[model samples]
Target chain A: MQIYRFEDKKPFMEKLEELLKSGFTSRQLEIYLPHPDHEIEELVEEYWPKSKLKFITLAGGLSGCSAGFAFTIFTSLDWPLITSGKPLVSIPPYIVIAFELTILFGALFSLGGFLLLSRLPSFKQIFHPEEYGNEFVIKILREET
Target chain B: MSHKDTGVVNQEVNAKSAAQVKDQMERDILAAIKKPKPVYWLGLLITITMTLIGAAAWAYQIKTGMGVAGIRNPVGWGVYITDFVFWVGIAHSGTLISAILFLFRARFRNRFNRSAEAMTVFAVMTAGLFPLIHLGRVWFFYWLFPYPTQRLLWVNFRSPLVWDVFAVSTYFTVSAIFWYIGLVPDIAILRRVRTGWQKLAYAFGSLGWKGTFKQWQHYNQIYKYLAALATPLVLSVHSVVSWDFAMGIIPGWHTTIFAPYFVAGAIFSGMAMVFTLVIPMRKFFRLEKYITVDDFEKAAKLLLFTGMIVGYAYIVEFCLAMYSGNPFERDQFIYRAVGDYAFTYWLMIACNVVTPLTLFVRKLRRNIKYLFIISFFVNIGMWLERFNIVVISLAHDFDPYAWGTYTPSIIEVAITVGSFGWFLTWFLLFSKTLPVLPITELKEEAE
Candidate 1:
């Protein structure tokens, strides 16, 4: 079994560089930390066909809001209504629609963000020797026995 | 030292201190959330009990009938409607503080954002409840929606009350969504920071967000877009609420001035509400450093500005009433000033006008105790402001025989108290569970 912690970029690269040069495959997993270089991720795909890897990325609030808004508005556009001799798509009335849509979207998006990132409804947390840290640790892992 | 040289040195020193104040301000905010409080969840308990009691009272009001409160021919909307306007008006400040300030690039909002955002959510929650509570048949409340039915019941499209259903519901939904969405990245941060149930909750809300470039790119784009969208809500929401009265045939309620008038008063009372909540929470949360004197001063400045507008509206209303030379309108204005409800009118003036006018002085703005005292009056004043608009208008019409008084029954008062409880409870729970401050948004602002 083997364990590697990705800290600074230089150390992480050096370790990966050694792995690439030495051709150490199998029974290993590189824990890809948050905001890991896309090229390195690409490299993993190119070089190691079956070697195990885990990835975690950091996301913020606005993204969640957008997603939620998009889901609600697009999904419910067909909702029927008539008022004020104005077009169903009038500006003044639509202002209300837009406001509600934006808010609903922002909320659901946040909830969605939490769900996607956190991997919730998760009851058991196993200390399976193979742990990855994206926040402070970046990458974490365990090698096969 | 030469006289000219002495003046120059003092000016330079003042400039140096001004620069120092900004730097100190930043460091102070950074220290605030980091310095933890004992995390007394008493607020959480109190708020819940209040919410449940509110719920029970609302349920009882519905089951018994609208008569459970003090609604009759003269006073159609007593506490419930007054509260609806009051709570909706209160909802204004959150968006004003968070969205308006952000658009204008005001850095002072950082300290109050979490509290303000939480305020928006709770205020809206409180507002949303009144509509249902006011609905004598709460069960059939959904009938207000323009849904196709076999019974062929369609909501009155011409009625401003129906417009209110659209405006208030939309405002609350969107604002709540905006508030929650802004909270996501912070939820992720909290997820990373804590363990056990806290971690679980944050993790759930964070939605597996990894804060990568693609995500941040999308997030920033969406946030900017949403901010743009939310800004107009500041105008539209209160205007729509005002339309509820404006569309009516009542002389005072039907005035064209209502839209702008209500919006101004909404903002005035809204700022006061924000002050009332922030003053206490800042102390309890030990957040004095972040929610600094500057933020309070700025808000007070806004409160005064709105107060002036409200005062202007008062003057204009009387002028309009007299100039129009309609005895009915003139009589209504007179009754409002010196009528049976005179005490409420005077209270409104004292809180919204005479008192907040003191805020023109910077010293009183920063005086926390004074802010709280004034804030209390502002609240009382703003509430009366709505009361006078709704009840007083109804009490005195063109016909003297219809003129009547409205006194809230015990149930009406209970429900109002319960709404406050509900609002506070939701807020307290939220503050503890979520990162009130949008750490990500603030980080962006700082940059």
Candidate 2:
């Protein structure tokens, strides 16, 4: 393989022109250099450009309310539950319990998904090591100056 | 004076280190599962056998009639009623941890939320069975509902049992839907990650999720809306549950305070149950890192706080009975301390009150074994609380002629055992079949 060297932008352009004239195409490809304008495009388009996001935070607000009401009703006394002159199945009071169970169940399900995805409690190997670090194959490509 | 290497942002190859960490975590999980001795299985088997015997007793009850149980005359409700109360309380902790904390934006919930939710669903299923089993002729149980039949009679929406029917039914439906919906993406991840039977099972559960952009968007929107709607329900369900007894005119039962008090106790007891299940779960599932000690600590502290609130309610009720100046009300309070059911009331006080206070010690709260011990005691206390509330009030009332002592027959105990077995069996199945965590969400959050 022949290496190309450039001392300045003029020489670099000349080398590129020579390569074009020589009808060069890259077959021994490893890594391609990035263009300057790509950064701007990425800034506008990427959903997560910096830190990798991990989980969806879920709060089961309404479901908790519904379940709480159900909990209240089931826990009450037998036969005619008319207390202190209130209606047997007081609608006004039951709302408190219905709400709690609803939210509770909702939050729980959310966690199940969150944990599985993160590979949590996965006390075994999931992925090979080389995939994460820049250890395998081409590390970097450089031009001589 | 200072030369810093700021240009080198990337670290040298850390492939080996990363691989080791990944492999270690995997190995640890496998080891965690393996560590639970065969004895645990033997215990489960014994429990199942006991449960089956209980089921046989239930078969006899079905054939002989509800009359076979001790309930009769003034004591139409006995052990079945107590069980209904107990199971409902057991079901409470999951929602209390998952929903209430979630609404408060507590991150501590993330650790054990999955297991807690599973417990809630199972507990509710067990709890729901009690009311139906209490009905002598389970076949005609549908008659309790208010529906238009050719005979032209409407159900008494006035019945607390009716409210209970609606409340528990709604809870089961909502909980079932919510639990399944939350598992969808996790199931898909499992489908992709697992092989053979696991892949097929996860695939079936995931219903062909492709991780499409559209799917994520829709899933997030629906989940958000459901959470908003479900938040209020957490309080509402338990409040309604309180009404089923608060509506009763019995001296102890008819108190207005029962609504909020019961709701608080439900949450308190429910939180304890979560600790009870979670301590073992993290160990069994190798979820120590995900469900950290911090979570266990927070939960234990919460159990203490609730236990105190419940204790306060107990004292307040006694004082209020005195203040009301009603001789009958005064006597009911006195009887609670020294009557046929006196042993139950005192035992309840010890279990629900004295025992849980032991958790006030920070060291005790942090210890998993101690937390497990205390959580179970909380459950016992809660169950007794329900027993005292229902049986004590019913067994003694305004008219001495109506006074009666009630004891649970063997049939009643059997059915309760069976219901618990059923719950445990379902959980066992779920553990084998599903990935208990949401992988996609974790990826997003962690990244």
In candidate 2 the C-alpha lDDT for residue A79 amounts to 43
Misplaced by over 4 Å in model 1 are A1-145, B1-42, B444-447
Report, for all candidates in order, the number of backbone clashes: 26, 117
lDDT of 2 by residue, B280-323 (tens): 66777767655666567788788888888899999999998989
Per-residue lDDT of candidate 1, residues A15-100 (tens digit): 77666555544234434443324454455545554211011111223443344344333323445355546454344433444454
Q: How would you encode candidate 1's per-residue C-alpha lDDT over B313-391 as one tens digit per residue?
A: 9889889987877888888888888999899988888878799889888778778899989888988988988999989
Candidate 1 has a DockQ of 0.07
The count of backbone overlaps in candidate 2 is 117
The lDDT values for all models are 0.66, 0.62
TM-score of each: 0.74, 0.73
Deviation of model 2 at B30, angstroms = 8.1
Highest DockQ scorer: 1
True contacts kept of each: 0.06, 0.03
